[model samples]
Target chain A: MVVATNSFPGSNGTTFSPNDILDLEKGDPLVFGAYWKKMSEVCTVVIKGWELMSYLSDAKNVCWFMLSEFGDAVRRLHHLVGNAVIQERYIVVGTGATQLSQAAIYALSSHSEAPQPINVVAAAPYYSEYPSEINVLRSKLYQWAGDAALYKKNEPYIEVVTSPNNPDGVIRQPVVKSEADGKLVYDLAYYWPHYTPITHQADHDIMIFTFSKCTGHAGSRIGWAIVKDIEVAKKMTWYVHMSSIGVSKESQTRAAKIIGVICDGYQNIGSIESELFFEYSKRILRERWEKLRKVIEQTKVLTAAKYPTFYCNFTNESSESYPGFLWLKCDESIEDCTSYLMEKLKIRARAGQRFGVGPKYARLSTIGTEDEFNELLERLSNAD
Target chain B: MVVATNSFPGSNGTTFSPNDILDLEKGDPLVFGAYWKKMSEVCTVVIKGWELMSYLSDAKNVCWFMLSEFGDAVRRLHHLVGNAVIQERYIVVGTGATQLSQAAIYALSSHSEAPQPINVVAAAPYYSEYPSEINVLRSKLYQWAGDAALYKKNEPYIEVVTSPNNPDGVIRQPVVKSEADGKLVYDLAYYWPHYTPITHQADHDIMIFTFSKCTGHAGSRIGWAIVKDIEVAKKMTWYVHMSSIGVSKESQTRAAKIIGVICDGYQNIGSIESELFFEYSKRILRERWEKLRKVIEQTKVLTAAKYPTFYCNFTNESSESYPGFLWLKCDESIEDCTSYLMEKLKIRARAGQRFGVGPKYARLSTIGTEDEFNELLERLSNAD
Candidate 1:
């Protein structure tokens, strides 16, 4: 049997083979599938046909579609991890961070029918998907105004700040400090201790998080936001309701179970029966980062992104960042780094140009299956 | 036990009470919960945390998030029911029909950059949420042009045709005609044999359906669109991809199991053990509509929308329309019937003005829990 009681290695029977074409372009987070697959033996969910059949969950709240159990579980997890502030904040759930960010833009811009659409900006080397996601429908409420650092408009703007940023592991802060009123949306998808050290609990006007990055349940398509203002939350809820009616209650119920189990595991820490989720995920990500760095050192063909050490309050230890993605720049001789890797090494990766960077840079995912990661290391080692 | 081997009556443990301020404003669809709760004994779903961990399901398909099992089950159920043509169609999955209708508009308007946004038209007394949904984001791609019957323009437009339409249960066809080209999106949420008589196989350019209307699994938030043109399907897929990343695999998996079970039961028809889904659901809805009509007859204060009986190809019988909502127009004495009902009768319903109709009409949901439906009937019976 491929299954093991405690820990298993190099025997994930479900994922694709290392011999198959490695798609490191997207941060799929399937690397943690082995951990979750093992955890399922101890934690399981059985939903009957009649369970969670209604469209409404809690009618009293602004986000009426959100189940109380799921809401409680979200608060419990945030309280347990000390990642984000839960007190006096409204929780709005979305299909994913992709949708929630759009919801944030809608919420921020929906109220005022300004003469011109509000400019939405993210700093250069921002998440590559921001532009496509914002401009998806040609929304007249907000338009993608590229590069927050360069945005000099004295008009109201919404800036999305992705911490422990995508493509690169650098922790970020909002850069567009204009005289005009600006609303900030923090994309804290990577604010968990597994990928980076929890320096502080995030407290912002609107902060977004995803279950995919936290629990490796990407297929669930569940993401949530913590909003300080009720009106903003309501606007976001209305946007979501008009767009998709509401979030999936099946995903919400299942999410409640998953997050509840996660909190329970940590609360029972130090017991032999307890199995830690972050500990397993962090170890895997840490090892992969080490291997990639060593391969880059040996090959001398690429420059890996560097990060400063941080004291993680949760772990009470200092550690370097292990981003969900590996941002690499070609060593001066190469151009269009994404094309070179895809053509020469057969490893698919996203070009940095998509993130408002030069063609010499590319971003590769660190959270794919183990075989794919191993194959990436092998290819990188032989690059020279 | 609230569990019956063959049949049970009036002992539902779930849902709200008749005495608890009935909310019939939205189509909640909890009446089918009684049937599903019983059917769950025969069909159960157990999903593990690790299974379906990857974001990608089938990378080859336009809708990569759609599981092959779900696609197959959808095709099989449609084939068995003979309500829709599944061949030469590309099935694109969304959060629900709410999202897919938006996707259809986007798909039709995305490639073209007109000086002015295209007018999206739906006939009067359409789904109450149509205008709000189309103008949700004040999208630059399309704008809501109310009353398709009145639209007289040579410019390109997108007309939504909802058959067995919401608010009013009359069968619908495209109302707008023009010299310029126009795209059609069919909202076939009520094209099932249980809700209305499926007169013929619906073969449209783009047809959207929902699991909530079909199987009373509203919480699953799963909807699919069958498109004749591959390019339009691709465009719709792109819109969904940027919006929600993709539909929930958890919902899709459960939908596959639920629909698969329904198909299996039908294939085993004539056996003593076999129990039909549509027959069970149709019977419950038929009884509710009959009871509601009786109550309306007792109280001449309101007039209900009329419909013509049709021969159902799937059920092989003639039946009157059992709409998911009750569209009622108050007598000449009453103005703003929704306000009168909410304030005087203590019943909540959506006003007709929301559906591009007059203040005298209001739409109440007929698919709420039995307790709520019964209370509505009792209250109406008491109305003078």
Candidate 2:
């Protein structure tokens, strides 16, 4: 069997001529046949097109509940938390959660009377792309000739944090309260129904959600924010109208339909099938983590970080937690873990420094099936 | 049957309940029972006790492209486009066309080395929401404590012009060249393979495209952009990553699939049945436009911008061009034509002032089917 390399190579050296079209099996999930199949099943009363808009437009009663299906889904998602609430008075949807995040920062930073520049802070060993998100914000400023900067300790400004953070997958709850108290902009991208339920103590801050991660339908590209404050929601809506013309109406519709399936006991074959997929992934990841833990302990070549309990390192601690990542810190001398892994082990993993972590460590996602994970681990072991 | 109202009045008449669900179509588009009636049709491959993540991990390729049948279709699309050369060097894709537009602006405006703030200028009587797009950019500056006023010009710094523009349906192919010189951004939101090609003389500053207008699959929010400069592309990529995590993998795959089916001649369906949908939409649109044109001429209530011969708008006084938009100027004393249309006739059209056109003029769309178009004209006649 030919092994797939983890690199995007400049030239194809493999004789196998990868990406050759092969006969496809009808049952393949990758085929996205399932959605079509599910569509066929739900086409009965469920197939009503554009009912949400009509419902909203026709409502002669309280306007709070007349949201389109997608809007309803968002409302339902907010309701799932029980602590959260929705309506024109309390909530508004954005093109994506990203729009809301950027808008929230803009609103806080741009308010006429802010005493200082709006400083943005995320817990170290957090999502590496936070900087890039800020970069987009900063780039906007650059166009406008605005001055923005990253968050620094001792600086009085807003802070934003991502829980179950990317790259490291660390769950940062209550620990962020210090920043939250400072009226910092917080991004709880993953604190949702299916993900870890960190019942938020505060309500009126910026919280981000996406159907992609929680619902497993990444292609829909739908994300929203739950702002407890109505004013913030209104401002966010303004930003959205200016930015992307609003989210894809169709995507919102699809997300709303899928949310309906999930809420109604997830009756459709798609959600049921999706549940199975996640279980399998978790089982495989758990197993891989067990093996990975063993390898790290046995090899003793390098250890993991303790704080954040993630696959990434932040404070140079020696123990690590697996939120779904194996953040391994190899010898400190290694400048580029990406090149080393590709050149020596033929193992593909993310270089840590890209994420603000030191270059000594690397991040490997255990996102594959157990078999694939085992095979990859086997390859790594063989290389070692 | 309930008459569709623009806004629903709640019981007390203070709040608005939505009353236009049918018009918006916010839920599942499948139109169940009408299309997919059976469970077997919906239930193709049961993923057997796995969750989405599990299925994702265990899937053969662990790539969404390799997972679903629709995913398969999208994979084909990616391969098709990925294999092609864009501007001779780069291959581009976006969450949808809108994201690319916003991203391109971010890259171009931020990277300019000039001391002057970047200016965003759009042609007069353009998309109603160009100001909002500018707002998003302005908000970015606010986030950074930057002043966005630097970019504003009596003639906007970055000019946004559309061919076959919305509200008017004026196909301004050759005429757009006047604004395409150094200070403009082109919104080719409506440009497609079948429509008038505007890119022939397209200047290389920035351009945007969307699939909803072209593909008839607005629900599947897939759009893309092509940038001539690589540096701009890189910066756009950074912002995109922070936006929606590179769009939806599933949607991308499906988009790819749909494109493949089109290119390969859609299988599992006949050419004639397939031909009906396309033929019907076009026929209906043509019929509507003819009726609309007749009514406008007969009413003589307002004048539309001239439609250009060879898609060129003539500004030379002797030019006999009439564009598609019914750009009406209805007595300048009437400050807002949009409000006047709503109050007097219950007709809804955008205020021309929003597009930098002075008030008392409104922009109307000719996108509806012929029957709808005639109905709109009849309603206007009755209201008048």
Candidate 3:
């Protein structure tokens, strides 16, 4: 086991590679995956689309209950991506996938007279925010019971399975397979063609998706959950109505426009080269991952997540790892990889402890500006 | 006392006055207060403002945490309206004021070890959705404890004071005046110049405001709270972060633009007539109220909410009742006013029972289109 260290080399006479030189004073852009700026030219149409006379004039687009246009857009995007089955699924819009995640937990939990608060669990190395988000309300309907691997109760529980998982970038299924009935909420926020291969069409009881991840428009804050169960969908819708009186109509309209653009690009694939959002995003993500992998391999300070090659039905080709986040496991000696990277290299990373894992691991966001990605590569290459 | 009857005229040789006729089947626009179409000409400039190239190019505006533009706009609107003091308040944004209301409830509740779930109460004839919204979460931190007048608990509780209250548009103060330490959350959603007289610069510890009611941009779904206490503000912000990972950035930008337009109109008051949103809205609301009062008075089936004439600081005149919703009390003989209107005249109104009030009262939204108001008036006048 290679021991990872935070200590700087003091007069070791080790020559730094020219490629390893990076400005440490400048902060790392490994915090969020908002890649809007990277595809500004292609997304310019979205801003221009808002100026249409019908955009503001039509009250028909913003029905208080839900916009059919938005629902249709969501359905279209799923169909275009070929990641999730749109048919026989009720789409419930949320402020974001964050809201939908909690809504799913609430929907799955028992709401009977003798209310039993169901335990909500996710596999280890989960999305960092899930635990806090679930427990924030300290709700009586459900409680965050930590990692699903440790969840031993035979009672009904909710297991969140984030495919192309947030920090780790691994396709996951429910770990808590039990004789007891359990509800699985598939967080397919990163199941888009840009992030991963569409190995199979996800047809879960509850699956959540967001425009933030799909189009790198995190600012839009539009998310939807495809639910097979009508009762669960109704419950989720009720939760949304009670929470925020429904999602933002403005956001929904923008999302619908963006989704339409994406679909249009796919439909006119031979006609558009640089304008195809999915192709552009996938290429950028793949390149960034490849560059980071090459640099990190040279340093040998951290090991990245290895993904098995899968044939993508959407792209009609074999695909490698193109995750939004690069999950890095620091060499054994690094007690806290996040602290090591920050203190020594001035590179901020989310600690694995946040994701119900030990401190030897950290997660870096791969979706950022090209300049930021280059700077991240320079810093990581100097890790040794 | 005259009784409100659901009984339609059954060939009693009663001549139907053509002057008192209404196109009832044409449908009422009482559903939404989206005034985008009305202000489209002035707001067209806003849509065009997005085309300045830098609008979509600026990734800084869509920060993950909070937008300063939104915060500044909130402050400017309050200053422009002169309804609330914003100098010392920390502004926290929400998906809508609906979200902030629940956030305030969550913030006010206990977070201690052996957490005591506090009671949440609003006055009788309160906002109709308060009960359902509060209880839907079924949170351990707080529970919907019904009418504040009947609330006998000496323990800690939260009292929601919705000035220019929803359903029944009456300015309200906290009903539960307990010596026990209780927090007051002022839901000033309709305290804008268009809805009511700016009685005073409301200096409350916790005050909530929304762009939906003020600017008639219900589709934007942007609401904010001016919280005095640092801890409360932090908690509210955290709740927002966990609830939806913050409000939509697209909504925030739109709100900021619309608010900027409103403020600009105020700044250039003499130059424009119909372009001013607040002035236009106030005139519409005032005229609609007058028309509604005239028709309802002649019918003698229901009585409207009475308001004391107060010297307005914003408009500089003694303003009459210009409520968003007309709180109509049915005659003593009538049990359900909502049912009576719906059954007899195909008119739908919010049931009084939803607001913890007697079935003898109902609420009609007066902020709808001119056509809806006219139809409602014609139906009410012909009610015998």
Candidate 4:
């Protein structure tokens, strides 16, 4: 117990120091710090050095590397909130959704004996990392074949559908109208009730989720793939095994504890428990969106993206979508929105070119620290 | 603190149950559980939900995902033990040594402009998984070329040198003779004082170490590369980011705590901090190897691998190598030792065929639970 004293950091929430740069280029999810800090007492986890020592979690399961606790937590979370369907699906855990996505790419294309790598395509303005992420391997099995919306051929391919997508937060389905049936890897990262309306339970063949976006625990580096096919699940597990051996058990244990707390908080709504994770995050994100929209209206030099209203099955209420990242179009006078903001306003935003679009559009993360968001608004209002 | 009660699983250490089957095929490292259990009080880690909120650890470091605490611990341990060159080296963390190895392959082969995948070679009787591990990527930049010792060409290639090698615990170095310069990825997984003598501070260009093998924390899923070249470190970092974004912060935090405990125990040798890690583990491994050799003598049907004696710089004492695995050769009458052990004696051992050797030899993991090892010895001595 004395040895644990040094490690048991006081549950006063994340100790954050303000940075000079109000950079919102990446959705780093430091904004989730405040919420977790509020519930810090209930969110802290204690692990022993000798606990969970084995590399294999459950040998009987198809995904032998995934912890039984984590698998249960994921299934329970999805079941609690009407998100992805979990029954009869194999839960294969990975380091993160990035690894799972790559695994999906590998698993889908591995069946083909063709010499050429299978084409991997996503819609225009996809997650900026997709192209380079896939190309990083330079695998002979697959290659990034550009935007699916522009792909003219009907040849077999791997289609990535980022519903309640990354850049724009617009609800989307597959746009690839290929006659040949291609495999689908659903990037349902933002499909949580906090971000968008869960119109229907995601019944996709392969759906990936991350603890970072779902519970604001990006540092945990835990994610899972709800794979329908047993062989694909096994292959994905093989990919993870070949890559990282498996996800960290410490991370999985922490994830399991956090998810349990979130679920318990919801179930014990009238009790001594604190705010539900989804409700707390949704309120913060909604407020951030409103403030950004007001700043955009005042500036009249930038255009904030608009979202369609939809009824959520989880909340059972009509609301506009609140995306984690803000996609803004530049005014006609500005040639490059990202550079203009960086140079003139001292705000850092990811340029549109990285997302397979022109420089006229740029992205700023709404899920930054409160101070950073406020600074962003101040800088936007002062824009010339 | 009320929330902490549930997550604070008591550090009584590694609740292990003896299994029906004695599986000695894999080097899972559950043997370290008992040592940790002995130091359970000082071995537990407590983490708050809001702590380590961001995805990045240190933005300035080449390995942005690596915690500064972990980096410091690594440097201190290597410095204390005199096993590696710590100065001017860049540390890149991965999920495990498996991922780091893949990253090393990518880093070494990234600049090759050749249309064909670069050859990856290891000597015969090499690590069993090397061939398939490299081939799994099927990357255009690299391919498994097999047997570095027998490559009869002058072509550029990537060579892997696993010192204190996996199946056989023998210290090794680059064996290839080529006119054109080739790159080396030194897998120093078993180079610790427990397995072999620290002949000299390993000054290999790209050296990798794993927490699983070093500290016996495989479930933590943390491994690092001590890369001499800045470019290679950066490229490995890029590969990690593209694959898994980064290693888990919780895993790093726990590793930092455990490594700190180990170092502190050694420094405060006269105090009541319990046994030093290396001292404890080395004693256990030596006893296991001795017991195994005695059992082999009792059987008279198998010959145990004989290692040369040397003085360890860390221990400052004369000792013969105590391998984590038992490499044994069956009698010439037996065609396949693996099948003979499994079918007749009910002992599971990895056949030499997987290691690119004939089936006369087999490997049994010495790094398993005490009961498993006892059972292995019992099964071996009972061999007819």
Candidate 5:
């Protein structure tokens, strides 16, 4: 799931300093002026019909949970996804997507009998934060053995993997031969109502999604987990309970209530705000993906896989797939394409070695909005 | 810290069903209609320029650091002695008091070289949920060794030992000798600018606090932790990092922004709402305490040590106190006070045995506002 770079391993180290990944840096999200302006619209939706005078009166409905309570609306959201059978069986709410990712890790790591160690496995060119999630799990606080290097042999364990995975954004189907009976902990943090559909139907996988991209409530911190197995779901629930204390009750109650309203079909799903968020997120990603695809196509550098799923494995001269992220295989003799690109363009991209993919490949993510994406493309294109 | 009932072990199983705690909960703050109606005034000082449109814009400020935005005002609060030391050393923020409590437990139980098995040596008749905190820590996610009824010796430890405990409103100072190293975990959840003097120096012990009691933002779920020892503070910070993906970032940032205005000079500390909440909270506990104290005084049924603290040990007939909570001792001949009170009055009080305080003693809480307190007094007074 998207663990923010601020949570990087050496963040707590004495010499740690903020960088592009860790620090939003020129990111409007951190600029209170812009955020506060947008928050006004959010607040209007948040607290609409409130009247100060009514509270002085003697009314039984003055309690937090009244007929008009936000929680009532959130509970109704289940009906929107008509396919979601047995809501409790398939869903678990989280404070945010990041939380759900960690909870999924905790659940997979904990299901072992006698508190044994568990291995977290992700495909190459994975989410930069996957390793950090491992660090958090192995953190003395959560106390699970989260070794990120590789799956040690002869160990009976649970393994975490991502689908429509981070950076590359490619939907990966497990190689049937290689993954005979190994457990797969899938991270589908980006999969939502309109994104690419996940294909791995293995019963032993847990998938995560977030509202930041799916909905426009990035600041709201709402996310959910989809698990097919009931036992795994139970463990996940327990982990959520133990870990977050509980997801923000205020957030949860409100989300459930709003979702309840939407699901009941009482409110129009095509509301302006909702549609705006969806279109904004999807359009930005679509444009970035297209631009990156064109770059690879024109340069004749790395063979491009597909448009939506841009992953192409490089050869001896270069290796690693270029997906949602442009995984570039920088050569030692060529002054390292990634370092050169960064110095020349002021662009920031993750080094693939961090993702257990080796030192040759460097990854660039599409986290920026449309404007920033355009800027990044122009900067990168002009960089010799 | 005043962990809210919204957390694991703290999840409000007391009311909502488990399913509600999971899939049906919301993950957004209450903004519109009934939930937000008239609620904005509750933070008028903190959220200045009281126009309704301001809330939306203000909600954005919730993510920014308060000191950075409102440095001058916050400096005023520094003189008052709450956990306002906002820095990496002494201050750390949480999603709610519940989050900090859970984090503290994790920090205590998961780190250390020869980590001894943990034992939470809470004083008698403390917050009833201490056991649940223990349960969460011992759960598969956190993986410590302890139950409400039992404890392990090798785990790192967390002893809740609250001051001005729940159910019982008595303020308690440790009766037993301190650790030779003088390490103590103190929960001053309610000792605030409202209940206790803010200027008084807090004992050199680990402490937790919540906005619910003092700041009247129970729904917002913001809290802070104060640790005398720096190393323990760092460990707790790490624990917090691993929990809730870092405390809703939104809530803490909002708290940082708003706290200054609310705590302004503590001048309007005598505001109608503050007085109402304090009197209501205090009068209810005072009424309940007086009834139990009256019963003990009249019947001479218990020989509990009379102290100003939230608790007193029932040295004679009962095994605990009747200060904040009415810990009644009833034998076969005498009615099991808790059950008897519940069965006849349709009211509920915790069974003392739930607190590891053994059977025979029943603990009853002082719940709700003034009127509810009066109703409870009538119920208990008429209970023979």
Candidate 6:
């Protein structure tokens, strides 16, 4: 069971330290679930790229049905970050990772010669939307087949491995352990430096990534996948094409500019004090985790999973916990953590049952504004 | 069989008219298929909408998981254009009309408790993509059941009606005569006043519209649907959410602003000599049709369809031929119109077979730049 927390603190009679005024103001309440304050900061730094305006008028970019400069930018960023392998991989862009997730499912199962619908499994405590997203199509290609851990089938199946899992933030592997015609689709949406340590370069058959989690450009709705199989890539691209003709050219162009700015910052790391996007993002995430931990430790109402230090190749340092979401497990005495948090502390959270868990766990977003996080800490501190 | 034509005339004996001064400089050859040149002209008119900037910062617009301002704008435009009835209808926004097309198919088919897969049919010589897009999913809920005109089945079915048909410019109705259990999805993509006359308000159960053909903002990738059934609307919205997480906020916001500019221009009509967007767009399309017809008449190599003039209520005038695509039929001597155009005239076009018709017909886009259309005319004129 896990509980994720993202709250803003009340100013009066709070044991928690006050958040920075600049940070508080930067956290525009208008953008829920987006890290725009931090993004705006980075955007301001690279505000003078006149070349970006060319994307606005370039008709070549508009007809980019197969691949765009945005896809190139994504590949370059992945190479620079050393998160995923790009060489010999066919990249398929989508509206978001959510779209790509379904695209992958379709590509993997649609062409299968199997007579019956193939089963799709993800480990329990999975991203809540996976089951619904997969089953909603009612496609004969595949069907949602409950939790991977409980699956006893030896038939053809596809296992989703969401590393740095959505609700719990734990590194995960496929639990079904099927060797007979089974496939693995790695959803590395939260495997960025800000969320987790870049322990190793991911070299999976199929992997998905999103700009939303990476750059907090959730509004752009741009995501991509790196597939080793050319056929799978083509099928995925076809799905994207038929789904929306192609991802938005305006969004893709803007994404390309934003990604280019990020890559440039990383390339010229030594000259700037902020180092790069990841450096600043990691710092902010680490600080929030530390402050939240202090408040939760005092409350004893909920406990977060303790993660071990890992050697990050990009930073060349031992990094602690810095996950996108906080998975908090409620005390046994609390029957429904999601409801308890909402009623007692006025903090809304996703209940664990949604992720195929019991009522004692809930997930809260830790990647919101500074004010929201501070409020969550204050609420937790005073709840007891 | 239908052949859509979008061609431009060439210059003098030098194989280059005065277009080298503009076309060569504007990078015309690079974007042969896109509507960028024409789109850029329209974009310039609404370039100063300062409200668009707020969309960049306002996350409220980003987290709008439900209906958005873009949907509202789309409804307003539909009402102003007298295309689709918006009152009491739920508007669901999508990446483009393409996404909404699939969404409608899914919504109409997935919820049925019928024992067998629902047969999906469209009239022959339909939008060629209907079969491929529907069958690609290989969903058990629905399957491509072939031409609606020839369908003799008594079972449940969904019929697609693409008015101002893609390859052909003729307005269409459902060919399937089963009113008992038959469902119709109206693809009114080219039903705008610019492309066709506003004969009467379209009040279908499910209707799809696109910004690509309307405002030529193909790059924006925004489209919408007016669904009469609330349940169908909710299911369509669910499909969108699971598909791309509610479309790109940036794209939607931009679409809203662009659509707003269009509607505002119409509200203040007669004040400006340019009039509204449809007025300018219709003028260009009408002029192109006239020029292309004159060239085709002189060649006697191919024949364009002659559409009847209709009194448009919106513009309060009798409107002539103004279609998004020109459906051309090659002379009896030419077996394959698409190849004949390419081999003899060096002009590219989509074959009629793609639209489930005989090879004698071909489609060309009339929505390109002034130079492209002129170049096409030159190529046709020289071919004879």
Q: List-wise, what DockQ does each model earn?
A: 0.56, 0.20, 0.28, 0.50, 0.19, 0.31
lDDT of 2 by residue, B275-329 (tens): 3222233343445456666666665355555454342111112222222235666
Model 2 lDDT at residue B15 = 21
Q: Model 5, B213-290: lDDT tens per residue?
A: 444444445666666667666667666544544454344434443455345424565342433333333343444556
lDDT of 1 by residue, B1-384 (tens): 111111122334434343455567888777777777767755577888787666787877888888889999999999999888899899999999999999999999988768788999999998988999999888888999999998899888999999889978889999897777898999999999889998888999999999999988888899999999999999999889899989998899899988988888888843326348898889988999999988897886888976789899888899998989999999988998998887667788899899999999999988877666776887888776
After superposition, the stretches of candidate 6 with alpha carbons farther than 4 Å from their true spots are A1-67, A269-275, A382-384, B1-68, B269-275, B299-301, B382-384
Question: Which number leads on DockQ?
Answer: 1
Candidate 2 has a TM-score of 0.69
lDDT per residue as tens, model 4, A137-206: 6988899998989877767889999988989998888988888758889998899988887888999999
Model 4, residue pairs in steric clash = none
Q: TM-score of each model's B chain? A: 0.94, 0.64, 0.85, 0.93, 0.62, 0.84
Q: Which prediction has more favorable DockQ, 4 or 6?
A: 4
Q: Write the per-residue lDDT of candidate 4 for residues B1-384, one digit (tens) a residue.
A: 001111112222322232344577888887788888777768799998788767878877999888899999999889988898999999999999989999999998888888778888887678888877787758888898888888767778888999988888878878889776688999998889888888789998899999998877888889999999999999999999998999999999999988888888878843546667888889989998898888888886788879999999899898999988888899977899999887777667899998888999899888877767777777878876
Model 5, span A1-384: residue lDDT tens: 111221111112222122232211211121112222332333322321122111111112121211233323323432333322334445666666666777676665554553444544555565666665555424322332233334444544445556556655566654222332356665655543334432222233576655444433444556776677767666666655555444544444344433442343325543324323223334444555677767655543333345243222111122122223455665444445555555555556566566656555666645433334455555556543
Q: Once superposed on the true structure, which residue ranges of model 4 sit more than 4 Å away at CA?
A: A1-20, A269-271, B1-20, B269-271
Give the per-residue lDDT of model 2 (tens digit) for A1-117.
334322111112333222221111111122122332344344212222112211122133222221366666767655544434454334555545666777777666555343344
Each candidate's clash count: 0, 88, 2, 0, 61, 36
TM-scores of all candidate predictions against the true structure: 0.95, 0.69, 0.87, 0.95, 0.69, 0.85
Instruction: Evaluate candidate 4 and give its CAPRI docking class based on DockQ.
Output: medium
The alpha-carbon lDDT assigned to residue A193 of candidate 1 equals 90
The C-alpha interface RMSD of every prediction is 4.6, 9.3, 9.3, 5.0, 10.2, 8.3
Candidate 5, B22: how far from true, in Å? Answer: 25
By DockQ, highest first, what's the ranking?
1, 4, 6, 3, 2, 5
User: So what's the TM-score on candidate 6?
Assistant: 0.85
Which has the higher lDDT value, candidate number 1 or candidate number 4?
1
- Show the lowest summed lDDT stretch of 10 residues, model 4 chain A: A1-10
lDDT of 3 by residue, B286-359 (tens): 88788878887887678897777777788787786587788888887678888887767667677888789888
